[model samples]
Target: MRLSLLDRSRTRSGYPEADALHHSVERAAHAEALGYHRFWGAEHHAVPGIASGSPAVLLAAVGARTSRIRLGSGGVMLPHHQPLVVAEQFLMLEALHPSRVDLGLGRTLGFTEQVRRALRQQTDDVDTFASDLEELRSYLRREAPVTARPVTQTVPSLFQLATGEGLVTAARLGLPAVIGGPVLHSPELGEAVAAYRRDFRASAETPQPQIIISLDLYLAETEEQARELALSEAWAMARSRETGEFSPLEPVEQIREQHWSPRTTSRIEKSLHRMIGGPAGIVVPAVERLLEITRAEELMVSTSTYDRDALAQMDAAVADLLT
Candidate 1:
């Protein structure tokens, strides 16, 4: 089992966003030292809780700090930026880091109308996602419709962060993909992975179908402690859905002390159930089942916690299980 990590550089209550950003670079170096295969960062805009606004810049920081592990975006939302700018940013990353960069792309819009206006992005941008991806690919291959400078054949491996029709698009384009969250725990997973493999076409870059499952994972010595470790993020998720704003991760004790409505309680419980937690006995079997169903080539865990030390401990434990 190949194991990797997806760090969103989540901002916590008492810490500065700068710390979250620096922690991402530090975590990538730690992951490399721990023998993890890849370390992927995320891109989020207008989301105060997450500090990773630019995947290219964040990845450059990680790339400079780490040598062995593969570095890339969990995804850069394609709808938000120009294809050429995206290409140049990542190409510069590849140029600096050599063969260790991965260009993970996705089609997602801004979280709010205000954010949409800020990015000059609209919901209709999704309709052009496939065409946009092709344009980016063409630029990388030096076959663009318009001439561009810094012509080089060097390109990073492409991976799509997708589900449903997006998964099929990735297959048609012959790119590996990452999918998980609620879908991994649902019946739709088997069909989704199967369809991705069945409809896949080989391209010169990626010759075979490859799927990587990404999930929320929390592991601790006891189920109680593990659940506690997960509460901050779980509460944040519930609050974000119920309210318009996504707040920073709170302390476990603080979360427990809050008065929650039935709706928020249910949302928190649902978030908890979606995550894989507890001891090796519980977590290992769940991971095994996920692997059996998806038959994915790799697994990536997106973990959030207030305590960096506990997070690192959980990561090391999960890494041991993968071995």
Candidate 2:
């Protein structure tokens, strides 16, 4: 039952950088004090609102301030950067923090179509993930000797098995596995977990498959608040998913005005149908049920919302659970 922070570093339109950074640092500190097990980030490109373009750099700053919590990416969208450069950066981070880095990888393009084209990462970008991931693993094995750049002084060799092909390999390779895109009742997700379990093997370096799942967690004081928050978050996701449009956090009125028809609501409900409840409504109970289902070694909760109160309530729910 470890808790962590998952943020896109969203800010209000026309906000100052220093002001937003101050709030983000404070939120990070607050989550730390609340006994969360980790603080992780996501990667988004050309998103005007999300300030978290550099997850590794932000994690380093976060790691410098926190003594106990683990710092890592919920995912570094793999197609954007050279895997060798990423591996080197993360290797340096591992050198700095020693046994405290987590690298979650993903193949999905995290940028808009225009930006993707600009970055030369189109639909044909699958090979980048495969090649880069392989190269990174090679670099981490430290067998192919190369001129090592100055290491970041941490030795966290906890490589994340991030691909669909590699979730099963996590068992064989003894690296931890993380799988998202879990539609609660989907047999597809079940098959994925089953595949991973079947391929799981024990090695001298690591004996067990550490599986982590990301779920949209709604935790608030009441169900109404939870729904409101979830709607806001869901709307934000819907906007991102529907249009390539990204912007600063819209005001409540503006967000509410974003058209929602039954069809779109159904789509959203289908997208997040697995998660929708308050802390008392389902945070612990839902997590407990998910654990019983996936039996994952860990659960990484991602609460997507532009509302600061909703964000803070996530920390609050974790606090209440601990209390």
**C-alpha lDDT (0 to 100) for residue 300 of candidate 1:** 92
lDDT of each: 0.87, 0.67
Q: Which stretches of model 1 miss by more than 4 angstroms?
A: 124-126, 146-153
lDDT of 1 by residue, 191-299 (tens): 8888889999998888989989999888788888889999989999899987888888898888878999999999999988889899988988998898998888899
Predicted candidate 2 versus true structure: per-residue lDDT over 1-323, tens digit per residue: 55566655665655765455455666777787887777777777677667777778877877787777777876777678876677877887777777778777766675667878876776854465555665666666664466345454444445453556657556666667776654444566667777777787775446776667666777777776777666655555566666656656655567677678776677667655667567564667777776777777666666666567657867677666634
TM-score of each: 0.97, 0.85
Model 1 TM-score on a 0 to 1 scale:
0.97
How far out, in Å, is residue 69 in model 2?
1.3
